[model samples]
Target: MSPDLYTVIKQICEEKQIPEESVVSTVELALAAAYRKDFADKLQNIHVTLDAQTGNFRVFDMKLVLENVSARIKEEALKLARQKKKAALYMPEFHDHDDEKFNADGVDLNDDDKLIEEGKVLLKFNPRTQITISDAKKIYPDIKVGDEYKEELEVPGDFGRMAAQTAKQVIIQRIREAERSIVFNTYKNREGEMVSGVVQRVEGSVVIIDIGRVNAILPYREQMAGDEYRIGGRLKLVIARVEMTPKGPEVIVSRTHRDLVSKLFELEVPELESGTVEIKAVAREAGSRSKIAVVANEENIDPIGSCVGQRGARVNAVIDELHGEKIDIIEWSANDEKFIASALSPAKVDSVEILDRDERRAKVTVKAEQQSLAIGKGGQNVRLAAKLTLWKIDIVQSETNAVIEISDDEPGDDTENVSQ
Candidate 1:
């Protein structure tokens, strides 16, 4: 009996979010495989078609016509016939009678060659697999060689349990393949963007988040150091990358990427979105502190004030999202000396001089008391300042008696004093 495929197609389309045409094609292919396996001969090429609207189905057998059998076709048919002959020769009934003779080897070589010749003749004259021009004319007066003929076959009353199982497996496999394609296209476009999701589960140190239709993985290395990953908690994540794997597409998300701060700022601040204030650069140590440089294109608008918002509300919102990660907003300047001085914020600088223009190196002088603040704890401030300004900074402390020079590469304890 014909199955009600229309309802099944609609259901699959809605559940899988796949196109109706794709589901219909998948069903047709599954039905064709089931029909061929259960009812058709091995050599018969069969096709199955289903009516999408009415749930009717039909099957066809394809046959090739040839003028004279080609050498390749003859060889293939001979090979198949020999395989069958070998199987029949090893049967118990035949083996019992000729066991000794056949086991002796090299006996009646002519008989073997005769058997091969008979098999070739039988295959060459077989009309179902191959037909000659004269034979074709009897069936179709205007038939030509090298043409294909298709014959419709009666639809089977029922496909057995095994065939039903095979069809179901095919449908499932096709659906998985379609799902992979959809997911790949969906997330591939979302790379380098921020998305919101709920924490689905935790596997060891990795956290899985349900971002709408697909799950994204946030590896331990990409997670914020102090953030708690509880199930059902909501998180805003950056889509670091999307990769295709043998199982399916994998989405890699991040919370500690430096760009995450930039994206968050873009989300909160409208001036950055409208391109009034441009973020020149961003330097971050995730879960700790970050420095961002912004320049205002309009003279009346203040870049720092806009990002900071009324009473520090906008920047504070971003800080709250980052779990109290400290952020320093600096005004960008084209002058290397001015920009370098501002990049080291909260630390008063006495002066900044360009040491090497070609090498992009600068010497910054600060008061002796501000040396520790300029260098920061573990030299993080100088490191981020250098990255934000794209310059190598050498901090020189101005004291009453001597000058102490400290390079960012050197440890905080390693300070060299220059005699006046």
Candidate 2:
């Protein structure tokens, strides 16, 4: 009778969230290995069947009967026999003969004559590899060569310590493999989607997040600027990618990704979720500022108004998720000039001229009073606008209908050329 393992199998299935069938199969395989180790030689074809409900198992040894044994089987049997002989020679009982007849190295003068005789019989036929037709008749009266025979073997109620340790290793390996599969399937589907998790711990510059099913890695570069990552703090991040490593599946998540803003908007705005509104592009500096271009597919929908919600409720919620980051929701345009004009928002533009279309350079004319706003603090606004529009922008000041070209090539130093 086998030990009752039904309770242990049930507990493993529940705790690991693995299917009962998978757990049972793993346990069966481990038990088979343990039985082979404890009751049969390595070369024996041993199989074990387990009754999952009762936890009782039976073992069988299968062998093939051949009239003439194959060379491969003959070689393998001889190799096994030699290994067993070498092990037996090292035993104390084998060395118990008179020490006077042996040299200092424990080599007996008479053992040399015995070894010469034993080597000749080393390659003799082994019963485990092949049973003669004459011997098969003793076990089964009608048995013939080329027939397979299976013998049920009696096993001890408990496995030895070594066999038990082998079973434990097999079980642990199977569980790890199952866990890796589960994590890969779970996180692979969630790529490019938002996920909620808690800060589990920090290692060096990487933060490990507990995302319900598995732990995700948030590298230092992916962390939000100036955000505190205290243990147990809740975070909403985007799944940047899912990778399979030798150790296991690794989920790479990001809080600094621009798609994080898009995902947050999807969560906050019904239009985005319903496919009525689509995001064309997003330029973000995480924990600081972001600009998104949106267009409405339905004529009845006002994409900007929908995103802003009634009295800025929707945008505020998204902003709060990002830790008070500034967002500019602008209407996307098919016309490059109109899009560029809209991209430089919160500042009134007099006109926009395409300086070099092939080079993607543009010149914007703003009122002298609005020049500082267009250029923004440390040119951050203009830089973000340029990035969002995918254009090289040069802000020119207009005073008294006269344009003064300002070159932004030298950062932090404004070089102006007067033009009429």
Candidate 3:
């Protein structure tokens, strides 16, 4: 209402990141609601205007220019009085004349006359029902009945301290909701990407992570097995899934996915990321064991050795992030026999017999001393190898006696020259 209104609106627009036009529109709606409570019922055509230069605002009630006003009112009355058609004479009294004003004898006046009188009555108003106008000239000469009024909106005085307090509370609540919604939408589309979040709280096996804006739930199933999350600790996780619910979007992030291992390698192993070396496969038993296979496109570059780095420095950093998880880096090979043998590392394979090429099933025979090493501790090694090669593997000791009845189509080795 005062010059300060412009400043107030502009400041709110900038602070909220809401457009200036939107602030004006919101203020107009609020004024319209106030006017409706204090003024008229035919508010459909009400309009609000704000002066850009001075921030002066005005409310105007508008009505269509009817060719026959009396007829229109009669039509409106009939539409509302349809039930009285059978008893027209006994129907409730309906008047086209105005009801807000009356003569001294209590006879209602015409609509136009009543409007003028009510306007005057409304202008001389109270705190909850009125606004002020300032005129420097007339001893106050700038004032007029229909001219735009001015007032400084003092939140505590104009609205009573309690009402102003309530408004402050409302604004704070709305802001919190807006911030939550912004964060939810921002992270909802981040499926399959890495995110850094702080551990806000841990309940049972679930950790509530605060990702700067909103809290995201990290379920136990999505976390690396046996991973211990402490409050206020920072974590880097990959968004695995997003579920839209009535409240908002629920994002499931993980540190245990096979892709997570690949991503970590991509971050730590520059050779694997640069296309000189490509990651072929990643098999992870999170917090326990992981196997990654890589291939070098350039000659003389050993992909496995490069990823391991000097004295295992490069891969060690990644393994430390997984809470001391063990990592096995192996060379990627297109040859299934070589790949399967490479996957089952720390053990030498005597032979790898491809039993079913279509099924990708193979039997890996290792010497007696290498049997325990080939299978690894509790079979973790062989399991990871199977996953890395994407093959079904059967491990057998080389000395194990077995009889194989080969079909006649299978050729036998020729030893006639050696015998002679």
RMSD for each of the candidates: 10.6, 11.6, 16.3
Score each candidate by Cα lDDT: 0.75, 0.73, 0.61
Q: How accurate locally is residue 42 in candidate 2, as Cα lDDT from 0 to 100? A: 37
A best-first ranking of the candidates according to their TM-score comes to 1, 2, 3
lDDT of 1 by residue, 66-142 (tens): 66554555555545634431111112122112112222233342343443554443333333344567655776778
* CA displacement after TM-score superposition, residue 395 of candidate 1 (Å): 1.9
Candidate 2, lDDT over the whole model:
0.73
Which segments of model 1 are wrong by more than 4 Å? 1-3, 60-154, 356-358, 398-420
lDDT of 2 by residue, 74-178 (tens): 464456444541111011232212111223243332343443344422223444334556656777878777776556778787898998998899889998898
Clashing pairs in 3: 138-141
lDDT of 1: 0.75
Badly placed stretches (over 4 Å) of model 2 are: 1-4, 45-49, 58-158, 201-208, 243-249, 353-363, 394-420
Lowest lDDT block of 10, candidate 2:
85-94
lDDT of 3 by residue, 244-294 (tens): 666766778888766777777778778867789888777777788888888
Residue 198's lDDT in candidate 2: 99
What is the lDDT for 332 in model 3? 77
